[model samples]
Target: MSTQPPSAPVAEPPPAGWEEARSRVYAVGLAAALPSTPRPLAEADGHTLAEPLTTRTDLPAFPTSSVDGWAVRGEQPWRVVGRVLAGSTPAPLTSDGTTVEIATGAMVPEGTTAIVRIEHSARDPEGLVTGVPRPRPEWRLPGEEARAGEELVASGTPVDPALIGLAASCGQDTLQVRRPPRAALLVFGDELLTSGPPADGRVRDSLGPSVPSWLRRYGCQVRAADVVGPVADTLPAHVAALRSALGTADLVCTTGGTMHGPVDHLHPALEALGADHVVNTVAVRPGFPMLLARVTSDDGRVRFVAGLPGNPQSAVVALVSLVAPLLAGLQGRQLPVLPQVTLAEPVPGRGDYTHLALVRLDRATGTAYPVRHVGSAMLRGLAGADGFAVIPPGTSGSVGDRVRVVPLPLLPGERTW
Candidate 1:
């Protein structure tokens, strides 16, 4: 008979405002699915690991030569016995007075303790050399870098290129990683069209064109994006478009038609589809109207929908604050908090709002300066930005004050500043 008591259920709190609601949403959103199937090491870049990796074989499996030199026993003018090429397994290196010419990366002969460069040794027909009186241990011993069966990498680590090299050295031909989530972007606005030749007060559909690329950079497999007109009188078309997207996507991100007004029909549409609002608004400036919702399809599978501000800059900030972290979590990534940095200029008055200021880091001075343009609707400001400095709510900073800055997603080979 089982003696364990039934676990008591804790009381659940009601979702309050944005911060509390978002925290709850993230708790539920994080890596709900187990990581995806294992992939070959060749295809694992940009993927998150499903399981920890241990070394199968020692790095530099045997004592190997570190330089193009002569492998010898003790010091001194010695006779050349034989040569050991990189691939050939030489007979057990067992001579003290004799030397063997060993190429770089070749296995060090069994008995040779030190390696002397070929240039340092004089060759003669009789195979005797001088000036090489003492031999130093130049051999890179087996398992010196990493031993077999050691924990090479932890589970859920993003497969950075260096980790790939480590995996290869550990004899791993493949890795297990989370599957990239599939998503669709829908931009709703009658005044917007794709950029080209704009006519009659119409603006380009910025979110549709730009957001997908950003999503891809964060590891989302964005399948498609479309621009739908803002139909104030009837939002059925928009709702239908969203339903269609939900059919094939794990998430659907939309821009515009989110704020409170007669034309703001996204809220009602979401309610009609049985979606629950995780956050109706965020506290961050330039992204104050951002909203996130989680919905269950008719068959009970969950999906996420983020409603971003129509302005390009606001949309970008909202994505960074909400989407990036959420996606990273879902992909089994362990993202560290932004490292702190010092500001190069004073920002005194902007204290009421949580600010996300675009900034560039000075490589020479190790300082970060906020960029000039920070208007919510501005795109040019973001174009010149490398990363952002976060100013926490109710506090301002002076020129030399340090603040935390989050970096933009960098490509595999890019250097971090």
Candidate 2:
């Protein structure tokens, strides 16, 4: 059997600013939906809804007690009729002066006109209940919060834990949701390590560990087994890895090999695969060579590729610049709104390139200060910083300059500050 020859590489010049590159990427329009399926509510967290979700039943389901006291029909000093728990039904109150001892969230018996709080009510030795009922009834009427058949969530909504819980409460055992976009990682340098510390011209593979995690935050289902390759320093290896990934994933992310250095084989591989450049590169400091491409499979599936830089922090910026938006578009989500931040001090510019400086924002003030150790290859500044302070091309950011900032992924137990 004869092997096919590789295609000649295309050398395209990128526009000299970030906005131009971003516009180019946006215009190419690589957005496409992944498959939709019915997932159990137990497993629907983070998935996007493929259709509108309606409530199967009214919220509260029945007339429920809002206070742990008495469910009384008329005035104070009523004879206790029965007890009502959260799950069990209680007998009806026959007399006007009868009451039921009701727990919070318990279904109130028929003829319950008011709920008296335990603190406001008293139980006499004769088993009679007495209290002043607050002007308003403390009972939660059925459908008080939401009505049956009402729209609970719109199509394209993300199924968060709260949404899943809401669905479960509305008798939804399963949700029809869009599948998480599948992705494959190709960390291209030959010198990267899977394990130990950097030594003798080789460094630990940060992208392998970091990219997959970031992709998850961006709504991609990147399995552990698929985070393969810093492919060999050959054009063929690059081509092979990309081809294999495209077969399975809707998005393929490659770290490093973005530049035209002697060892950089990404452009050639992309050429060989007949991939069309969506955004060749952005004019941005530290990660100027970031690129996005679209590859059409023979089966008609269009897969996206995000080419990230070799440097650790640069790679992260590139991911934020392109892949995040790509994933958002694919999942039918809106582009995240960057928060406005005040710069604590001056951040110098880089000619026409937009500067994305990793900055630690004041926890109390929302003021961003450029962190130390922000070189492209360094991760120290990124680890400590809250977000990137975007300074525009050709101008240095002055103290208290207001600019948009994109936040890092929230930690496991961390909420937005």
Candidate 3:
């Protein structure tokens, strides 16, 4: 059976609301360490560009046929002299009463006035063309979508598949994007097993497989080399893991050991390392023991460490509170904007702390309903949840009350719908 260890000397309870706790970390400016670098376009998806995308060639470099049709000079009832398919050279039509058969995307024949749709044209026994052309030109003129040297997309744009396609259309093979912030994980718990199911009073380590997935979703690059293990519950082991992770990681995440339990060594270990706290404990339910700190590497590079609680659900909540915004800023991505939704039923908040409830969303109606089995140690609730619904300190929200919902990990500029 699990036991509650002696309480850590409670620091004065954090300012009484979730915003105050999050604002404290936001004020520290944690984004300076991540840098920008030129990256190949193929591999740069999800990165924010550090420079504008300038076109190397005019969009539709040649006059392009928008429809498969006959390229006519002026009048119909003309002779079909040649045929032009996409990528094929077309015989120039220089005189009136002459036409050339053309396929979609084929370059327009020189001196051609417009395209007559194949459905609107007919060939007589003598190979004479007869049709009334559409009023508008059915060909895209060069530079219609973009001109060479034009700025197609501004700097700081997030690169998605569509943006990548845009860059490729503009003749770019590569782009400059902010380098992904590198993070390392250190899961701390002597009772956690690396493999197999929970048995004999030891549980499986969930953070190793789960937390890194979250980090990657938020645009962080978690290298496999830096993931240390379920270190033994000892100060020396904790300190050793901390120092080793600080050596190469911009951010090191330590799971468990934030409290004052006999086995909890993160607080004392961090103190021994002269680390400064960014957020010691937040005034939030289920994950209040979460901690963020700044520590300098032996080589003088500044690094960060976040201590997550032992409970599986609480640890993930802490991650959403601390790491999500921090990584967004560090990766040069915009802070995520929380979506507001109506509650499907009444939910109460903790008297001294804010409550976050995992919820399922009816996106079509913009309403949130609480999920079941949501204790700190339980992961079942989160597995079926869409996002967290914020219930502020000292207040309750009834059905139809508007509340802010923090979305699960999303790509930049992606809409919840």
Candidate 4:
């Protein structure tokens, strides 16, 4: 079994409720880092743009046929004289009695006032229409969807594959986006180990592996994952180590040290380093002890540090609440959108605390129901959960109450329904 020092002290009990802790964290935080440079449009998914993208060409780029029909002259039906395909831009239509057979997406020659469907024309043995055409609107005008040089995408927009397609359609091959922040993760605990079967009194290190996934989800680059065992005992030394890590990192995350346990020296260490808590707690359950600290050395350099509870579920919650926001702010990106739904039952009571319950949101019915195995210590609740139902602070509603839910970080290679 892992051993604690004989002089190791006992920790203070966790604070009574969520609000006290959350307020502590928010009051002491800094923005997250933003991505830089234009990623090749090929790999820009999930990145936020740093600049607005203007269209180089109108959506159609020219007057185009919206249907496979005959482009005709003003007010009068005419005989088919020629054919126009999508790529060829023939000279403008000048004849009043003649029509050009045009395919869908083909450019309409000038002077054509309307399009007559091929079915409406009287076709001869020569594959040409020889009769008057039905009256209709002219070809679709250029710039109907987007004018040339109009803004096709705004800055700070998250770029997905579809957005990339839009950029390409607007004649752009690359896009400017905030750069992902670089992070250093420190997992601190006496009983933690990198790899090995857990002994009777020890647990395997979880945050080291789990946090990287969360970091990547927010477009962060985890540069180092250092598993620092509970060997740190003094405030000064812990602060120095964190400072060193911060020197090379945009953000630092420490797991298992936010609580006031006797051996939990992280809070004092942060104070010594000129760090103040932004939010010490949130009114959210399952993540009460989450702490956000903004550490700025005397000379004015700032670093963001997050302290997460040791429990796996608590740690994940803290990441979502504290780290995720910091990451988005640093990159100058907006927070992920939370999906909304109607709840199936009343959460036990109404209070100043926001309850985060593991839940399944049925896409088909727009109903949300709490999932099983949800205590802060239970990993199973997090595993099978699609997301969490966020009951706001101080609000109570019966079944069918409307609640918002922040989606869980999706796993890699998971198919999107």
Candidate 5:
């Protein structure tokens, strides 16, 4: 019998459709999702759950008073027998014409017939309580909110503060979540400055400092030390940097060198590392040269590399286009859905390529207005924009036309008007 060696990596096909590229990247990441681990609720924020969050016990384990009232037995005009504050258990109403003063959230005692609000009840010098009970019961019964073992949140849901509170109420101290993917950034360019303003025909490296923040917002664990910049514009240097980053990172992001320019070495470096192209290029304006590749190590470990265009705004476009969906899939999350916004003005399309025009959303009016200085290499418009208004290929957006918006991930407590 003849045995065949593994197939060699092939060249990437023609530029893929914008949506197709995103979906393809997402699928690849999902197939290699990180393993699940147990994390304390305090540390689980911003992670995705690996399992459904179920209630360990009935929500409100016992009957609880919903109002500050008197728990009466048999009828009103009952003699006060006991009091029950929150977190305390009370004795059952053992006889007729008896009552217990109960605070909100206090467990209702057994054999209590009804609850009368304190404001609706009157007490005379005789030490008796009298009030008319409303037709509806004022106390919440056990499992009112959820039953024991009921699923409160589905798997793949991102953990937020509210989710933590809900999990705590369900008697959970730890959550089963997918560990965040570790990422490293490699900014490739010789004519880039790290500090101060651009000078001597060299521009400031904007992506090195900013891309890590964007990765963090997408739930990737990016360390300051992992962000390397201005790597010598040589093939060997590119290969060395990529190798080192892939050693400790699940994903490596490289800025610049995505195109086949004079100094571009990213494609050759990827080839030297035996990487398979997941996405070579996308049919999108301003960032069409973006690409994603999959690399495997000798020990069978898999990693990914995303090539972002060097232009500042174009790099951001690549981020939301390829990196965002890839991170979501790695964390066991579903593909992100774009929100719709009415266009406040007309915006031209890019012929066969999808146009992602920078826009600031008017939340009050649910409208998207185009921003200024939105050139492919410009950052001024990106800094002031809330998101991009997607005008699909072959069709231009008109006034009042509804379009999908790709929102920027805001840091916790950060807001954009």
Candidate 6:
């Protein structure tokens, strides 16, 4: 009796170029961006503006004093007539040789010729003021910063503290912004320990605790309760976890089980859910096995799933490469731009594959230097790195070469030039 051998596994398509993979995932996210809503200025931080921010009134609705000074009419040595403080309107300097003591940010009186700074003015016993007016105007005229109803910020701009302050200055009590995308994290790997160091071939799960913070930096709403981990390495378990996460999250990020190993069930589970592949793999070293898929839920809502590598550093690479752009698109923001940095040392390329080398940046010199312990599975180098120096395929990075650098997101209260 002739026995037929088991059918061979189907081969996946060739990996996509790094740039192409990122672009594809971004397109998918842009097509499914969240709806816009009105949020108060206090709640609008970390969201993208859904419409241009226009000024309700002329910036500095009236002429405003730039410093504590005397607003004089006609000429200097004027008689001091009145005082103006912030939020108070003063009578116009209707008479020549008349002046008003104006506080900084107070509205300048109408018909004022110029302002003499308080420090530069002298008051006589008769209460008259004498000073030389500087060449530049000491007070800002109405509409100096922006005209009434003029667009000050464009749509799709991410809201930050400065932007919020500007919006408030423009008389906006609430901003129209796109809601932050909700995300869920599911870490797949039976050999991962939740609360311990590596032992008996099981490594501690670092991505589960760290990825949520990274997602938050991208303006994603990832609550602690949304993170599920150490799922059993079975097809049923993978399918169930993904379904539950996808039911509520706009995007679900899964770590490990991307490859077609005997225990890897991610691909089979994705297929069973009828998910469409947006990107299967990328041509970047250390994170080449990354994938992105578009899944449609039973209620007709579309969601995304990003498959990150099992290695600690490789997973981070995948995040910066794929997830950053995708999040920007989902918020209706412009595509992320890579900053350029000069290399301090020579970096070897990966031949046909793109090389993403972890590097510490010398901001003083704008130079990038390779860091230590940057192996795919290690996190020590990543902890010290400022960004990744992207060496394109078929090219090695030479010292002093200006190359594109993908920066890590700054944590709260961190500033970058």
TM-score per prediction, in order, is 0.87, 0.89, 0.87, 0.79, 0.93, 0.94
Question: 1 or 2: which has the higher lDDT?
Answer: 2
Query: Can you write out model 3's per-residue Cα lDDT over 182-253, one digit (the tens) per residue?
Result: 789999988999999999999998888888888887777788877788888899999988988887777888
Could you list the CA RMSD of all candidates, in the order they appear?
7.8, 4.5, 5.3, 6.3, 4.5, 2.1
How many clashes does each candidate structure show, in the order listed? 5, 1, 0, 29, 0, 0
Candidate 5 lDDT, tens digit per residue, 56-77? Answer: 9998899999999899999767
* Weakest ten-residue segment in model 5 by summed lDDT: 408-417
Q: Which candidate tops TM-score?
A: 6
Specify the highest-lDDT model's number: 5
Ranking by lDDT: 5, 6, 2, 3, 1, 4
Deviating ranges (above 4 Å) for candidate 2? 1-11, 20-30, 88-94, 195-197, 411-414
lDDT for predicted candidate 1 compared with the true structure: 0.75
Q: Give the TM-score of candidate 1.
A: 0.87
Summing lDDT over every window of 10 consecutive residues in candidate 1, give the lowest-scoring window: 12-21
Model 5 lDDT on a 0 to 1 scale: 0.93
lDDT-better candidate, 2 vs 6 = 6
Error of 3 at 34 (Å): 1.8
List pairs with backbone clashes in candidate 2: 187-230
- Global lDDT of model 3: 0.83
TM-score of 3: 0.87
lDDT (Cα atoms) of all candidates against the true structure: 0.75, 0.84, 0.83, 0.72, 0.93, 0.92
lDDT of 2 by residue, 258-363 (tens): 9889999999899999999888778898898888989997888888889999999999988878887777667765566778889889898887889888888887
